[model samples]
Target: MMPIDRERSDADMNSLKRTKLAYSILSIVLIVIGIYLIIRPQTAMLTVCRVLGVVLMFYGIIRLLGYFSHDMYQLAFQFDLAMGIFSLVAGCIFLFRTEWIAELIPAFIGVIVLIDAVFKIQTSLDAKRFGISKWWLILILAVIAGALGAMLLVIPLKVVEFVMVLIGINLVIDGVLNFWVVHDTVRMIDSL
Candidate 1:
């Protein structure tokens, strides 16, 4: 029994080490890709656009099929059907207009960011009402995000370089944060 337990412990240790190694590699790779994307914004944006187009088309088809397969209320299906059509059209437009998609990518991202910031601001407001400490921090970050998004939307071309730089900074931070994850995992494994 003692021998068997020892063997099991050794195996677990080995597995944990391998997992740690894998995570470190993944984090490094992501950091590299992020840096590359920052350096070559246009190229990265184009690749992203193509992928988005394919995803949109795939989801659109699924949506259409699901709506047609079940006889739902015409009123509900009408909205769903319209959304599906819109998705399909947008996807096709992306697939065919790669350059155009690239040009519009910043604005699209900006819109998403702006929406996210608004949601964050709302959450912070609720937090403030609840007497949560540092709600203002969230509000501040939200405001910054909204400002950056607005810049992207209003002057995409001008903001393109800034966006790329921000992406690079985020990636670097992500990579650094991943190191913390690895450290925690290692500590947990030791505890186990």
Candidate 2:
């Protein structure tokens, strides 16, 4: 008799592949923007900071609305509330303190890169868990991302242009890997 203890179905496989495809596409866009940043480091830093500030403020407004509008998971809701407030404050700092924030943009980018590297690794693992083919490729990409992120953090930002170059290179490579992931996901979907 065949064992009948598996959770995967065709639908699950399709869903997984689709999700990875979407994620890969998004990563590709971000990577392209990153390349632009590399090309114009100083200006890009200001733009990135401004964008972040706007995002934070928008997120804060959304979250703050949630408190009044709907019921949320208790723990998650609490966390959201806290984060919403924090983001609002942080956003204000970024917007109002442009000069100070400008000075810290490199550090901010480093921290963001480092954090994203950790998530990319986890995302790679998640793809593997879903039985995506050539999952190891994502793992390799994750490793590369981690190394690049670490370099951003560990290296001093004495020369802002140097930091930009590193970031640019990382983004270009990241974008390339994203496309690879997309291609692999598409192949997997076709096979399925």
Candidate 3:
């Protein structure tokens, strides 16, 4: 390969690594938040909103970065650009209008998760085409997450605590699914 090409490849690899790391961090954060919600469903609404706002903003930035990174398969980050913008806007609303947003947070987050789950279903199919052995697992998890997200959307606001628990469960599952997909499918050139 030409020297310039090699340099570009190296830069791309570095960016990919950073993107993966950022994604991993975001996944971990989701798991932690999920656990928190599960354990303390009765926590103050404003505090929960603030925490979710920060997390959503962070996830948005990470998703944007991941979209720009050079993933070998290109499946993992395909929907990131749009999702990032959506997340950023949602985060802003949550932060600036916590009181107004508290009631709607579940539905908003449900939409985000549902969208991600749908994209992940596509990613799993692409992974199958690429001959990844664990693609079915991704498909199953994505389906489950999608169901959970749909439930969140339809559940009445009167059942806030139950909704919180469901959201926590969904977040945990989604986080694990994302982390596994990124680690399993996102390959550095040297590993190829």
> 36 in model 2: Cα distance from truth in Å?
1.7
User: Can you tell me which runs of candidate 1 are displaced by over 4 Å?
Assistant: 1-36, 39-42, 51-99, 156-163, 166-192
lDDT of 1 by residue, 7-62 (tens): 87677666545545544664475477557767776556677667657755754554
**Residue runs of model 2 more than 4 Å from their true location after superposition:** 1-25, 42-44, 51-97, 174-192
Instruction: Tell me the deviation in Å of residue 43 in model 3.
Output: 1.1
* TM-scores for all predictions: 0.44, 0.56, 0.96
Which structure is stronger by lDDT: 1 or 2?
2
Judged by TM-score, which candidate is best? 3
* Candidate 3 residue-wise lDDT, 24-91, digit = tens: 99998899889888998887778888988988999999999989999988888988999899989888
Model 2, C-alpha of 189: deviation from truth (Å): 10
For model 2, state the Cα shift of residue 96 in Å.
5.1
User: lDDT of each prediction vs. the true structure?
Assistant: 0.56, 0.59, 0.90
Please state every model's RMSD to the true fold in angstroms: 13.0, 9.3, 1.2
Local lDDT at 182 for model 2: 48
Cand. 1 TM to true fold: 0.44
- Candidate 3: lDDT of 168? 89
Error of 2 at 30 (Å): 1.8
